[model samples]
Target: MTFSKPYATREALEQTIAHHAWLNEHAGSLRLPAIRTVRADGIDFASIEGRHARFTDAPAVATVLGRAHAAAWKGDLHRALLTTAHPLAHGHELPDFVSPRIAALRRHRAAGLVNAHQMTAAQSLLAASPATPVAFYKDTNLRNVLITADGPVMVDLGDLTLAPFGYDLAKLLVTLAMTYGPLPPATFTTSLACYNQPLLGAGLPPVTIGRFLGHAELHHLLTLPYLGKSGYRHPWPTVRPRPEDLT
Candidate 1:
């Protein structure tokens, strides 16, 4: 593969290359398409052999999400969360959110997409909380998950890492919430219930589900600009949610 244009910096380029290598080496085990080549601008994905399929041509607002929920209607989402044990179980510490991310939250507040009440409460809670690592899908969302008859396969390999369990849950749920706006509290119960307590197992503590949901809410605002088409239309904070309101 060849990049039509280079990545923003050397570090970005190197990271992309590394992720590509990881994905290439592990795609079959990951149940994903092998990459014969990848560059900053293009990729050559090995075709699926049999009756492969996509989620839908015109996924309704919740189609990808609903499908994810239905697919995981069984147990063990952590299995779904990672491609394999290949990455050496990354991100043991909760890395600090960078400055640009903070700025995006500020922008959300400024644009009335997030209010001070939610912001303050979430920030305070996050600041006080210690890091707890679990499976993390950094870009966990409808867009990143692929459906095959074989089962669910995580497509975007780069974002897979070990992070707070709440974080992985938050990103997928919040990623949906961001696109469709605030779903009723019952939405999580019905659609996201597969990842609930029984599945998390007793070895881990109760995840700060709301706190991490808030983090996911804040985390993706900065990411919108980079996501073409994906960034369109989801006017956030129009109703001014409390931090715990993300159900």
Candidate 2:
């Protein structure tokens, strides 16, 4: 993929290489594009093995996430990644990536990036809960998912980390919501239940869906300025979320 701005640090690139290497060997049923080659500037992704799909394709998104949620859901892979102390695994807590972004927003508020109100709201949301850790494929969002004839494929391993249970699901839901307005109440609730199934089956505590949604919202709010008016279906924060909207 091409990017106008560089997307990786040396350290993150190394971790991504390692993670993909691991996936190449171990991702049995998880669909991933083959890493064709790696060079100084970037890695090459192989041509789509099936039909190229759009991020807006809802069915495709669900199918891919289901594959990930079930096939690699919290068990051996979680322990294996932890055992190796994988650099991509931000152990047992949500990474502190948000704090630095908030700081940057404050510093650039004069540039109209984020206002004081948004910053304060973000801080409060950050304090809402001590997120319970679960196996989070942090980059499992609409932008990174692809639907192929074989099934669904997820791409971008750079941000995989151990984060709050459903963090990855929340990110996907939030990404879709931001792009297409709030999901229907039934859809939101069903999605939450589906994401919590594996954890519950494993006798882990169920995710607090609201808290996960809140955290996901904060993540997208912090991301707004960078979007530079991409014409999303809804403007966030000002959208005044409804309880049913997240149910």
Leading candidate by TM-score? 2
lDDT of 1 at 240: 25
lDDT of 1 by residue, 1-247 (tens): 3213235555554454555454334322335556566565555565543431221311321233233332332222333322223232232221233333455667777877666776675455334223333333345566655555665555554444433344544555555555656656545444334344433443444444455456555555544443335732454444224555544
Q: Give candidate 2's error at residue 8 in angstroms.
A: 6.5
lDDT at position 22, candidate 2: 50
Question: Global lDDT of each model?
Answer: 0.44, 0.56
Weakest ten-residue segment in model 1 by summed lDDT: 52-61
Give the TM-score (vs. native) of candidate 2: 0.69
* Per-residue lDDT of candidate 2, residues 1-247 (tens digit): 5222233565555566766655444434467677766666566766554433333455445444543544443533444322123333332222343444456666657678667887777767644243333344546656676677666676777765444456566666666666667656555567666656655665567667677667677667656664535434565554435776665
> Where does candidate 2 stray beyond 4 Å?
1-12, 22-29, 49-112, 127-131, 227-233, 237-241, 245-247
Instruction: Report each candidate's C-alpha RMSD, comma-separated, in the order given.
Output: 8.0, 5.3
